[model samples]
Target: GSTMSQSEAAMAKANPMYNSIYSQLPQYFGEQPWTAGPVYVGAFVMFLFILGCFIVKGPLKWALLGATIFSILLSWGKNFMGLTDLFIDYVPMYNKFRAVSSILVIAEFTIPLLAIFALKEILSKPDTLKLKENRGGAIATLVLTAGVALILAVAPGIFFSGFITTQEMAALKQGLPAEHLAPLVANLTEMRKAIIASDAWRSFFIIVIGCVLLFLYQQRKLKASFTLAGIALLCLIDMWSINKRYLNDEQFVPKSKQTEAFVKTQADEMILQDTTLNYRVLNFIGFPGNTFNENNTAYWHKSVGGYHAAKLRRYQEMIDHHIMPEMQETYQAVATAGGQMDSVDASKFRVLNMLNTKYFIFPAGEQGQAVPVVNPYAYGNAWFVDKVQYVNNANEEIDALNDILPTETAVVDVKFKEQLKGVTEGYKDSLSTIQLTSYEPNRLVYKTFTPKDGVVVFSEIYYPGWRATIDGQPVDIARADYILRAINVPAGEHTIEMWFDPQSIQVTESIAYAALALLLIGVMVLAWTQRNKIAKKS
Candidate 1:
């Protein structure tokens, strides 16, 4: 029942949007308003025009020099490092605004440089510097930088960090219903990510912005024409560097789409609708990011991968073939008692076995109470259904899991469990393998209620020494106790994972050795090359 229509679910996806004067008056003007991309492009072009004036030997070259100094300061202080991730906590919609603003900055540099390059090719002179004074260009740059800084400072929180949170509360009060507000808040955060991509579009915006400002100066009254042209060249270089990255491929969907698709598919395959199937088949081939198929392997774990894998594998072996020792034993007893096990029953078994083709419905009971195993995927806690039998339930010959036929003198084959040897390389003889009672996708969970005797070993056979912590406190844990580590945990839940140690012989040693070797080789090559070059010149 916890389901949504496709269109309704799509609303939850991230879509970041920002507005400017153009957007506000767009209805009347019809598409003249500049978007975030254009603004960034414009800014970059303006920056380069300032740069070009300084490089060329011309009047107001001092002003061009001043612009260069300002560009460096603004680039680092106001642009590059100015966008901090911490603002999201203070400003309610700061994340969304930040993303779009960042993109605009890139566009500022890209578009201007492109125009400058085109003009140079048309003139057929690659190296020429001619510039005159652009009266108000300096003031404009200063004003833009100052405005951006002010916005950063007085944004939601000027006095105290706590005030930012307070402003958020006040803003939300007069808006949508409290229930609806949470979803919107979540959506805004996602939108921020879309606008923050470090890609070509951003570069394009920066160049364009720089060009427009220079072009303004080039107008006779404004003067500095040649300087603006040179600045455009610099913007072009930056833009080309940015766009060249995506020259090969085009059809790239956001990674977020793939992750969502995988989760939805898993959810759909988990509902139970039938109760007579024994075997389930899981095809893990198509699921993205290393999803395990349910048919080949099965195990008990809270993860969907484990549950589906186990259920389908068990169901297929038992129900489809009807050759499992347990089923064959049960059938022999019923047949001896004069009930014939016919081809019809075998056909029903086949249908039931194949129910894992998609997924079956399973019933959940109260916490701690054991439910009948309806789904082979979800066992122990729920009643599962064999989807195949659900459709053919009216057939009187259906020997469902619910039907308890009498058993004959059939015996179960005993499989002896073997003790595994430790895989630790150096001290294999000293360490013992720990028995895992349960496993999650990324971890194996084991319980040692009491500490094991004999040097308390944790045998691990991985390269790069792992970190060992006692109750989350870092300790001087060594590789010796890697596999069967003896540690004291509280009687409740305990977590452990193989942690990487950089100082050990695993990673750091190799890097250090490689560095030393490279240094020595470089010195030898330099001495030989210098001696040969001098001899040849003589």
Candidate 2:
């Protein structure tokens, strides 16, 4: 549930902290990273990486170096945000990805490749690493690694005293008194410094030991096999020691604590009773922090708001413009009116109803059980809106959602005008109706009876790869209500179905079959070869 909220996402252009790869206070300084990042390649491997740079031969070395350098620079992400922004703007498909530091996977691959090849060079030609420049390179590598560690270990404050960001300071100040906040900040900063210093010493000691072994092997004081074994042992110890810090016995909990973890609250019970096709649940549970970050609501119901990395960009846009503004207004009203379910203006939930949010679970009462508040004006699974309000741009389209009632109108982007095909005008009889007859994650079946040509809006999230059919013939589904699907339907009783059948699936299937056939052929050939070899030996 770490998906960035619409507010934070909107602010991302001005603030780099909201970017996927930007490090945070509790994460970078914490003992264990929240994203399971800061991938450790081991101290010994890193030492070999530096030594390998000088010893590795040919263009392969340069390729590996290039890969290493590319990954490192890209991994800086928001730290050197200009490069990241340049890639996002100019590089094709670069804008589609997040978690920029994940590019370090390339460095991980290249580092090992160079390290192994460099070791091979030394084993094959004993005097290779003994050359003046190569020896100096090796010495310099040790000096650089150890020297930096020594400085950081001795005086970390000199480099990172002012590490706290405005965001971090603001977050820390919450619920903290003026006198106490300073000491807390100081202590945390000291601890962060200590953590870095500790790790620096750890890296320094490991590298020194590795260097000592290399010196011994080069000078004929140790056997080649012993040197290899010692290096492998050192890498194991370093990795194991670091890994144990994150994956330890403390993570285990008692059976009682684990059992019934997703037990239903009273709200869940009330919500589960509603046997409708589908409806989204809202459990902001009285706080903005709970808005999109809590997944507990999703445990038993389809949530209107929940965190996920791959949430639809269109939905995010809707959140930024429609949902967030409406939510803030209602929450503010609720706060002013004394924070009760009755204080909530059900009328203000235009965006919410359009999303078909039926139940809002609030934590209340003596036992603190979830209290379910039914939104009576929920738009249901499907509806026939009176008109399609077209807008010039994204901003206009989103803002238009609030301008008119979502129950009567759908604000659509002008980009989708081609799909509408000059059929923007709509008319739905008050008696005319539509209901979701069947609902599946990928397929939806709806029954609609319209008196005339009208746009039937389904309370389903708008995404690519969905194909709409009226009775049997395929029809274009237009982007409607900012984050919903709507199709122009002819009058009379008809079955409307929408199914997800992405074209990419066909290509993927072909690739899978080809790979399978190749694997089978390889297996058969290998079996035949083994049989022939066994016969000859016999």
Leading candidate by lDDT: 2
RMSD of 1: 22.8
What's the lDDT for all of these models? 0.34, 0.76
Error of 2 at 483 (Å): 1.7
CA lDDT, candidate 2, residue 362: 62
lDDT tens string, model 1, 112-191? Answer: 44434434432343222232243353445434533343343334122223311334445555655777566644553332
If scored against the real structure, what TM-score would every candidate get?
0.22, 0.87
Off by over 4 Å in 1: 1-116, 119-466, 469-520
Off by over 4 Å in 2: 1-34, 78-93, 248-259, 332-344, 366-368, 529-538
* Poorest 10 consecutive residues by lDDT, candidate 2: 1-10
Number of clashes in model 2? Answer: 0
Q: Distance from true position, residue 338, model 1, in Å?
A: 80
For model 2, how does the per-residue alpha-carbon lDDT over 154-238 read when each residue is reduced to its tens digit? 8876665464556667876885677767765655555456566767888889888987887788888888899889988998999
